[model samples]
Target chain A: MPEGPTLAQLGEGELIRRLGAFAPPGQFDDDAALLGAALLGGRPAGDPPLVLNTDVLVEDVHFSAATMGAADVGWRAAAANLSDLAAMGCRGAVGLTVALVAPGHTPWAWVEGAYAGMAELLGSHGGVLLGGDCSGGRQRLLAVTALGRLPAGGGPIRRGDGRPGDVLVSTGAHGISRLGLAVLRGEALPDLPAAGRERAIRAHRRPVPRFDAVAALGASRPAALDWRVAGCDSSDGLATAASCLAVASRCTALLSRSDLPLAAELAGQAQAEDWCLWGGEDFELVLALEPAWAEALVEQLEGARWIGRLVEPQPWGPLGWTEGGGPIASPTAAFRHFG
Target chain B: MPEGPTLAQLGEGELIRRLGAFAPPGQFDDDAALLGAALLGGRPAGDPPLVLNTDVLVEDVHFSAATMGAADVGWRAAAANLSDLAAMGCRGAVGLTVALVAPGHTPWAWVEGAYAGMAELLGSHGGVLLGGDCSGGRQRLLAVTALGRLPAGGGPIRRGDGRPGDVLVSTGAHGISRLGLAVLRGEALPDLPAAGRERAIRAHRRPVPRFDAVAALGASRPAALDWRVAGCDSSDGLATAASCLAVASRCTALLSRSDLPLAAELAGQAQAEDWCLWGGEDFELVLALEPAWAEALVEQLEGARWIGRLVEPQPWGPLGWTEGGGPIASPTAAFRHFG
Candidate 1:
C-alpha cells in the first residue's frame, strides 16, 4: 500500500479529482455523464442524448435508521440522483434502477417501504422502475441510477458554460435543508417559528430536484441564449457549488450576500449565514446565464433569485462573496463526506 | 414490522419477488431493464433500445480483500453487469457508472487499481466510464451500472420469450467459477491439475462477459427470429437460471445431465455435479432458441454446448434433470445471498 493521506484527510473533492485522473480525460468531469450516440456532436438529429447519473447511500454513513425512516432513506437516495439530472437541465428521468444491500436480519417491511418510497417518487416524475439486484451485506446500502433524456433541440446545461458578465441565479433557498438537518439531529432551533421549523424539517427529509424549475427556465430562454446556461446542484453547500461552476467555466462568481434567499424565521439565527454559505444537503440549483436572459428567466419563474454575477478570473480564487462592498473574506467550510 | 419472515429467512429470491410486487408490473423480470423510448417499442424508427442493468458487490459477502485483489474485485463487479446485457442479446455497452463505498482508511492504490481493472475490461468492449459517486462506508461496496444498446431493427431478447420445444444452449462450461471459489476458500482440489486449477481461479477472479458471443448469436439469427431468442446468464447456477426462464415463459426446462457442458477437469469429482447444478458465479449465458436455430447456432459459435430443451408446462415441475432415463432427484441448493 502506498503511503499517503487517507480518504478522510483528502476529502471527497480531492479524492474524486485523483480518481478522475485514472479514467480517460473528459469522462468524470460532468454533472450527469452524457453517453451513447450523444457522445459525438451528431446524435442523428432526432435522438436525444441519454444522461446517466448514480448515487449510493450507505447505512450509518449517510443515514441512521434511528433518526431516519426507511422510506425517507429511499426517497432521499433517489432524489440525490435526480438532482444530478436536474443540474444538467434534463427534462425528466425515464428509468430508475435501485440496488439494495442489507443484512440478512433486516426487517422485510423496511425493504418494502424503501421500494414504495422510490416508486411513489418515480410515479410523480414520469419515471419507471427498471430491474435491479439485491444482495446481503453487513450494512444497508442503496445505489440508484437515474437515466434521463436531454431536450431534442436544446443541449444540456453543463457546468463549464458560464462566460464573463453572465448573471448567476439560484432556484429557491439554500439553507433550509441544512437547518432541517440540524433540527433532525436534535439541535434546538429556538429562534425558528413552528411553521418554519416544520418546513425546514420537511425540506431535509424530502429534497426535491429542480427539474421543473430548469425546464421552465429553458423553455423561456431565447434560442441563442440556450447554449450559455451553466448550472449545478448545491448539495455540497452554496460555496462549493458556486466555486465548482466558476472553476469549470474558467470565470469568477461575485455573489452578493444580501441577495441570498434566507427563510424569514432564520432572521435571528447567527448561523444562518454559515448555513447559507457552508451548510449542505440543499438541492437548490445555482445557475449562471447571460444577463438579459437571466433576468427574463427570473421574471418567468415564480421565485428565482438573482444573487451573483460571473466576471473575469479572480487572482485569489473562483468565488467571491460581497456584502455591499468589495469581496468579503472567503468561507473555507463545506460539508465533508469523511471526517 | 408486518412480516411473516425476515429477509434472511425469505432469502434473496423470495424477498425480491415479494418486494417487486410492490412496484408496477413488467419491471424487474428481465436481465437488463429496457427503458425510455424502448419502453414503448417505438424508438424513433432507427434508434436502438436502451438497456440498463446494475449489480452490487459487497466486501466479505461478494469478495474478501484478503482472498482477492482490488483489481479483480473491480473487474468482476463490471463483468457481472455486462453479463446482464449479454443475456438480453444487447450488442454492447456504451456507458459504465460505478459507485464505490469504502472505509476512509482504504489504500489509494486499491481504489486506483480497481478503476484500472474496470477500465481495461470496458476498453475491450467499447464502453466508457461515465461519472459516479464515492462515499465513506463501513465496508467496501461496489455498485456498477452498464448501459447497453440493442441492435437496431431487432428488439431485446427477453426471459419470457422461450417457446415450447426450444433447444437450450449453454455458452461455456459451468462449475469452473464455483471450483475457483472453493480453491480460493482454501479447499483442497486434489483431482484438478495445475492448469485446470489456474483456469478455475481465473474464471472466479476475472470472469469475462459474453458480449461478443451474444452479439454474434443475435446477428446470425434471421430478423423475424431475433426477438424469439430467449436467454439469461447463469450467475445463479444452471438449475436456478433455467427454472427462472421456465417460470417466466410459463414453460418447463428438461435438462440432460450427460449433455451438461461441465469442465473436463471437473469430471469424476464428487462435488462436480453439485457445482454444476448449484454453484453460482458462472458468467456463461444460457440461451433458449428454436430447435433448428439452436443447432445451427451451436455450429456457428465454437464451443457452444446444447444442454437441454424448453417444453410445454410439465406436471413434474418447471425444471427437471434426466440422465438418459427417468428424471433424477432434484438438487434444492443454489448460491444464496443469505443462507
Candidate 2:
C-alpha cells in the first residue's frame, strides 16, 4: 500500500484546498482567473479584463465512445471552459488553446472530427482557435484553455460578493444534461417523453455555455448595483453551486423548494427533484443579486427564476431549502472526482 | 485495419500540419503565440506583447518515476513550456496555468511534491501560479500553459524571419540532456568520468529554460537591426532545429562541424559529435543573425558559438554540414510523438 494518503482518500475538494496553498491567494476562488488592468500593466483604463479558464477532459472518465462521438467530446471540452468564462462575467472569448494527448493507434478521422466540432462551436459562439500542442499518450485527453474578455465598463462577478437579502437566481433548469447522459447510457427512464429524451441527450452532448444569460443580466442590471453580483456556474449541480457561493460569502443560502426551476419535461417525473438538486453538468448560471435587480432580471430573462435568498449563517449549515415554511435538510456533498 | 490512417502513421509533423488548418493562419508557425497590441485592444504603445505556449507532458511518455522524482517531473513540465517562451524572445513570464489529470490511486505526496517543484521554479524565475483545473484519469498528465511577455522595445523572434545571408549561432552545447537520459537509463559508458555522469543526469532532469540567453542576446543586440532576429530552441536536436529554421526561412543552413559547441565533459567521448548534432531536449537557443551581429554576440555571450550560415537552398535539402571542407549528409528526423 502507499505510505501516504491517496487522492481517493482526500477527495477533490480537499485536494483543491491543499493545492490552493501553492498559488497566489484566492487564485482558485473564482470561476475563472481575471487578468485585470492591474495584473496586465500599461493597459488603458476601461479596457476589458482578460478572463482565463482551463478544463481537462479525459477519455473514459469524462466521456466514452459509446455515449458520444469524438466531435461531442471536443465540443464538450470547449464548452466547459467557455462556461467558466461566462460564470466570471466574460462577454466574449478571444480564443482558446488545446493541449491534446492521445494513443498512437487512434484514427485520424477522430482527430479531424474533434477539430470540426470545436470549429463549429467557436463559429457559433465567439472565439477562434488560437493554437495548441499535441502529443501521444496511452489515454486520450484534451486540456483546453480559453481566453475571454469582459464587456467595456463591466466588472467580474465574484463568488464572495453576496450580501444578506441578496436573491439567488438560476438562469435555467438543472438535471437536463444529467438526464441526457442517462439517455445516452440507455438507462431506464420510462416516464421521460421522447422529446424530453432527445433534449436531454443533446444537452449532455452539446451543452451551451450561459453567455446569453450573462448578456441578459448585464443588460438588465440596475444602475445602482453596477456589477456587484455574486455568481457561479451550476456545472457541479444547483445545491453545490449555491453552497459554494454561500460559503465564499460567509452567508447562508435558503432556497425555496417550490420555486426551483424544473424543465417542462421533468414536471411529473419522480426523480426530477433529486436530479435537479444534485445532478452535474447543467452549465447554467447561478447568481446572487440584490432582490430588486434579481426580480427585474428574472422578469425580463426567459427561463430565469428566483429560487433562494442569502441570510446570516444558520446553525445547521450554509445551505438549506424551505418547503411550506419549514427548513428541509440540505445535502452538503457534491460531485468529487476521486470519490 | 480499422481506419484510413492512424496517428502513428501520420506522425507528429504531418498531424500538426493538418491540424493547423483548424486554427488562425500561422497560429502554429511559431514557438509561442504572440498576442500583440492589436490583438489585445486598448493596450498602450510601449506595453509588451503577451506570449502564450501550451505543452503537455504525459507519464511514461515524457517522464517516468523510475528515472526522476515527481518534483523533477513538475519542474520539467514547466521548463518545457518556459523554453518555448524563451525561444519566442520573451523577457519574463506573466504566470502559468496547469491542468492536471491523474488517477485516484495517486499518492497525495506526489501532488504536493509536484506543486512544490513548480513553486521553486516560479520563485526563481518571474511567474506566479495563476489558476488551473484538476480531474481524475487513468494516467497522470500535466498540460501547462505559460504566459510570458516580450521586452518593451523587443519583438518576437519568429522561425521564418531568417535571411539568406544570416549567420547561425548556437547559445550553448547540445546533447547533455540526452546523455543524462542515457545515464539515468543505466547505459554503460566506461570512459565517462563520474562527475560527467552526474552532470549529464542533472541536465536531463533539470534542464533550464534559456531566458538568460534571451536576455544576453537582447543586451548584445546591435541597434541597426532592431529586434529582427530569427530563432528556435534545440529541443528537437540541432539538426532538426536548423532544418526547421532553414525550411521556414526558405534557405539552406550549412553548418560547420568543427565549430559545433561540445560540453567540456563530452570532449573525448566517441559519440559526442553525433549526439551534439542529433540528440534532443538541449533547450539551447539556435539563432539567425546578421554576420556582423552574430560575430559580436558570439564574442560577448559566454558559451555562444557561431556555427553556420544560411544560403540559397540547394537541390539536395535545407540542411547540411561541412567537415574538412567536404559536405556531409544531414539527418532529417527529429523527435515525434506518435511515431
Candidate 3:
C-alpha cells in the first residue's frame, strides 16, 4: 500500500476539487473552457471564441462489453464531450480528437467499429474527425477532445449568469437513459411498455447532445439579455446541475416536483421521480433563462418544460423546493468514479 | 481470441492507418492537426489556424514505477504532447486539458504529484491548464490535448513540405534519454562517466519540448523561402523522423553518418551511434530547410548540426546514405505501441 489516502477515500468530486487548484481559477467551473481573444491575447476582435471539452470513458467504469457494443461505446464517448460543448453554448463542433488506449489482444475490428461510430455521429452533426493518438494498455479507454466555436458576436452562456428571477427550463425529459440502462441490464420494469423499453435502451446507448435546445435558446433569446443565458447539461443528474448553477450564480434553485420532466415511458414507475432527479447521463440541457424568454421557448420548443426558478440566496445550500419553500436535501450522491 | 485480427497482429501503424480512413484525408499525416479557415468552413481571414495534438500515456506501457515516479510520468506525458505542438511550429501552446484515469487504490499524493509535474512544465513553457477529466480505471493513464495557433501570416511546418534541395538539420544531440533509461534499468556502461549518467537520467525523466528550436527556426527563416520548413521532433528517434519527412515529402533523405549529432556524454560508448539513430524519446527537432537558411540557423542556434540533405526520389525507398550514394536500410523500427 502507498503512503497516503487513496482516491477511493477522497471520491471523484473531491479529487476534482483538489485537482482544480492546479488550473486557472474558475476555469473548471463550466462544462468547457472558453478560449477567446482575451485568453489567447492578440487575436483579432471578430474571431469567435473557441470552446473545448475533454471527456474520458474507461472500460468497466463508463461502459461494459456485456451491455455496449464497440460502436455504442464510441458513440457515448463522443456524445459525452459533444454534450459538454453544447452545454457551453456552441452551435456545433469544429472537430474532435480521440486518444485511445486498449490492450494488445483487443480486436482491430472493434477499434474500426468505434471510429465508424464516431464518424456516423460527426456526419450527422457538423464536425469531422481531426486526428488522435493510440497506445496499448491494460484496459480500453477513450479520451475525446471536442473543439467548437461560439456563435459570432455571442458570448458564452456561463453557469454564473443566472439571476434570482430566472426561470429554470429543461430541454427534454430525463430518466429515459437510466431506464435504458436498466433495460440493457435485463432489469424488470413493469410500467414500461416494450416500445418504451426499446426507446430507453437506445437513449442509453446513443444520447443526443441537445444542440437543438441550444439553437432554440439562441433563437428565443430576447435582444436585451444579450446572450446571457445560463445552463449546463444534466449528465450528472438534474439536482447536481441545478445545484451547480445555483451555487455558481449565488442563488437558490427552487424546483417544482410536479414540473419535473420525467420521460413518458417512466410514467408510474416506482423509481420514476427518483430517476428524474438523480439519474445520470441524461444529456439534456437545463437552462436558467429570463422569465419571458423561458415562457416563449417552452411554448415554441417541443418537450421544453418549466421545471424551476432561481430565488434569493439562503443561508442553507443552493437547492430548495418551490412548494415547501425551504431548502431541499441534496439528492443521493450520483455515481462518482471512486465512490 | 475475440476477433480475426488482434491489435498486436496489425501493429500500431496499421491500426492507425485503418483508423485514418474515418478521418478527413491527409489530416493525420502531420504531427498535429491544423484546423484553419479552409477546414473549419467560415472563420475570419485574419484568424490564425488552430493546431491540436492529443497524446496518451499509459502506465506500464509508457512508464513504469521502476523507472519513473508519479511526477516524472506526468512530466513525460505533458512533454510528449507539448513536443507535438512544438513540432507544428507553434511558438508556445494556448493551453492543454488532461484526462486522467487511475485505480481507486492509487494514492492521492501520486495524483497530486503528477499534476504538480504538469504544472511545472506548463509554467516553464507558456501554457496554462485549461480543464480536464478524471476517472477510476484499472491502470493509470493520462491523455493530454494541447492547443496552439500558427503564427499570423505563417503556415504550418508540415512533414510533407520538404524540398529536394533542403538540408536536414538537427536542433541538438540525441540518445541521452535512451542512455538514461538504460541506467535506470541498472545496465552497466563503463564508458559513461557519473556526470553523463546523471544527465542521461535527467533527460529520460524530464525531456523538454524544443520550443526554443521552433523559435530559432522561425527567426532564421529566409523571407524568400517563407515558412516552408519541414520538420518533426525526434521522439521516435532520428531515423524514424527522417523517414517520415522523406516519405511524406516524396523525396529521398541522404544522411551522412559522420555528421550524426550524437550526445557528447556518449562520446566513446559502443552503442552511441545506434542510440542516436534508433533511440526514442529524444525531443530535439529534425528539420529540413533551405541550405543557406540551414547554415544560418546551424550557426545561430547553439548545438545545431547539419546532418543531411533531401535528394531526388529513387525507385527504392526514401532513405539514402551520402557516403555510398545508395539506399540506406530503414533503421530497426522504434518502440511502437502494440508491437
Candidate 4:
C-alpha cells in the first residue's frame, strides 16, 4: 500500500528532493534560479548569454484530478511555465510543452478540457501552443520549455549579485499557497480568522506572476546597484526565494520577523509566521535593493513595503530568517517533501 | 506479466486512430500520399511551413534501465528528437533538453554519462544546447524541445498534392526498423538472407535522416503533374504514412508491393516483408513526385528507385491491396496498430 502522506502530506522540499533523484544533468535551473555555472567551456572563450530554465508538472503527485480538474492543471501548467519566465525577469515565453498520458485518459475531450484552463491564462499572457505530441500511458507529465528573451542591458536577474546593506523587498506576502494547501487537506480552521485562510487558498490555487514588478525593474534600468542586487520569484516562499537570490548575489539578507507577511490562516497549517517565511508557491518577486534605493523603491512600487537588508554572508541560516532565528527578509515557513 | 504482441504487431494505424480522441485543429493543406495526419496549426497563420516536432523519453517504459544502458538511452533519445527534426525537413535541432529523475537512482556520474550521448549527437548535427532543466524524481523523464529554421518555401508538404500518374519514391527503404526490432527481440539472424535486413536492424536502433533526398526534392522541383506534389517522412511505414497524406489531401495511393524494400533475414522471427511493410519507426522521407522527375530523381539519388504512384480515391483493402477492386496499380501493404 502507498504509505506516508500520499505526496499531499509531504512538504514541497522533500517532494522536490525525491524528484531530484531522477533528474539527469540537473542544476538550479529547474528551481527558477539563474544558471551561474558556466554553460560553455572553451569553444571561443566568450561568456554564455541567456539563462535557460525549465519545469515539469506531474498528475496526481502535483495536483489531484479529484480536486482540481484538467482545466486547473492546464492553467497551473501555464502559470508554472510563466513563473520560470518571471524568475529570470524576461519577457513572454516561446514555450513548448510535452504531455504524456494514458490513451483513453487523454481523450480529446480531456485535452480540450485541459486547453480551456490553459487558454484562460494564455488569453491574458499571450503565448499560444507551438505544438505538442501525445503519447499514451506514462504518468502524464507536462514539460514546458520556455524561451525567455533576456534583457538587452545585462542578462537574467540572478541571486548571487546582492551585496550587504541591500534592502530586501518582496512583491507580495507569503503563506497563501501553504494556507490553501492546508485548507484543501481538510484541516480544521485554527484560532485565526477564516478570511485570511480563504485568501491564502485563492492565492495558492490561482497564483499570478510578478510581471509588473519585473517590468518595473527592467524599466528602472538600475545597473549600478543591479550588480549589488538580486531577484528570483518567491515561488517557494520568501525565505527560500531570498536564500536562493542571496546565494547567487553572494550576500546574506536579514528579514525582520515583523515584516514577514503572515496571514492569520497560517496558524491552521504549521507555523503561521513560519509558513509566511518559508512556505512556497507565492510566485512573488523577492528583490534586494541598495539601502539608498529603499525610499525610492517603496515609491516606485504602488504598494511596496520595506522588509530588511543584506548583511555579511552567514553560513548557518538562509535568506529569509535573521541572525536571531526569527523571520527576516525571507519566508519563515519552509517547504519539505522527503525528509 | 507483460502481455500482448510487439509494438510492430499493433501497427501505426490503430495508434493514430486511438489518438483521434483529441481533435487537432488544422489547415487544409494536402498531398495525399497517406500517412499520419500532419498538423497545420501552431505556427503562424497561412504559412505552409514545415513542422517542428519533438518528444520526451522517460525511464521505465520508453526505455528501461534493465535493457538499455544509460548511454544507449541517451543516444536513442537524441535520435528520437533528431527523427522529429528530420521528419520536418529541418537541418537539425537548435535547443536544449530537460531531464528529471530520482536523485538516488541517478547519480551525477550517470547523468554526465547520458549527456555524453546527447553531446555526441548534437556535435554531429551541429546543435547547440539552448537550455534544459533537471529535477530529482521517482522515474527518469527526458523532455527535449528543438528549434528549426525552415526553408523559405517549405513547411507542411501537403500529402494530397499527388496526381494519378505521379510516381512514389522514398529517401531509403522502410521496415528496417521493424526488422531491427525483431533482432532486439532475441530472434536469431539466421532466418532469411537479404542484405537489406541487417540495415533495417540498424535503422530501428539508430536511424539516420536523409537530408540528401530533401535537397534533391527542393533542387529538382518537379512540376510535370497537375496536382501539387508533397512529401513526408514515413515514421510508421510507407503504408500508414501514405494513408494519412491521402486522407488529408483527399486522394488515393497505389503502393507497389514489388517496390517494397526489405533486408535479407526474414525466416528468423517474422516475415521480412511483413515486418517491413507494417513496421514503424523508419524515419525515411517518402516523396510523391511527378513522372517527369522520376529519372532525374534516380539520377540525383543515383540508386534510389521509384516504387509506386498516386491514384483516384478509394477505400484501402483488397488484401495485400487497397479496399476498392480498382485494378491493383500495385500490391502495397497496410500498416495498422492494434489490428
Please report, in order, the local distance difference test score of every candidate based on alpha carbons. 0.80, 0.85, 0.88, 0.57
Writing each residue's lDDT as its tens digit, candidate 3 over A113-210 gives: 88888887888877889999999998998999999988774568799999999999999999999989898898878867889988999999998888
Give the clashing residue pairs of candidate 1, or none. none
Q: Which stretches of candidate 3 lie over 4 Å from their true place?
A: A330-333, B330-333
Clashing pairs in 2: A180-A200
Kindly report which residue stretches of model 2 are placed more than 4 angstroms away from their true locations once superposed.
Answer: A42-46, A324-334, B41-46, B322-334
lDDT of 1 by residue, B78-113 (tens): 888988888887767776888888888877778887
- Candidate 4 residue lDDT tens string, A1-339: 332343334444444454444333444333342333243221122322334455666665566665566777777777877876776766554443444443333444455566666667766774555454444434555666544444444456656667777788876667778777777777665564667766766776677756666666655545455433477777656777777766666666677776766654565455677667766777877877776555565677764567777787777645545547543443333333221
Please give me the total number of clashing residue pairs in predicted model 2.
1
Assess each model's interface with DockQ, reporting 2 decimals per model.
0.65, 0.75, 0.84, 0.16
Tens digits of per-residue lDDT for model 4, B1-339 = 443433234343353343233323342132111112132223334332333345666665566665456666666677676655555555544445544433333444455556666666666764555555444345666776654434444443555555666677766665667776765676666644556555654566566655556656666655543324466667656666666655655666666666665543444454666565567677777666777776577677744667666666666532124333353332355422112
Candidate 2: lDDT of A195?
88
Off by over 4 Å in 1: A1-3, A36-45, A223-226, A323-333, B1-4, B36-45, B222-226, B323-333
| Per-chain TM-score of candidate 1, chain B | 0.93
**Comparing 1 and 4 on TM-score, the stronger one:** 1
Q: Say what the RMSD of model 3 is.
A: 1.6
Quote model 2's TM-score. 0.96
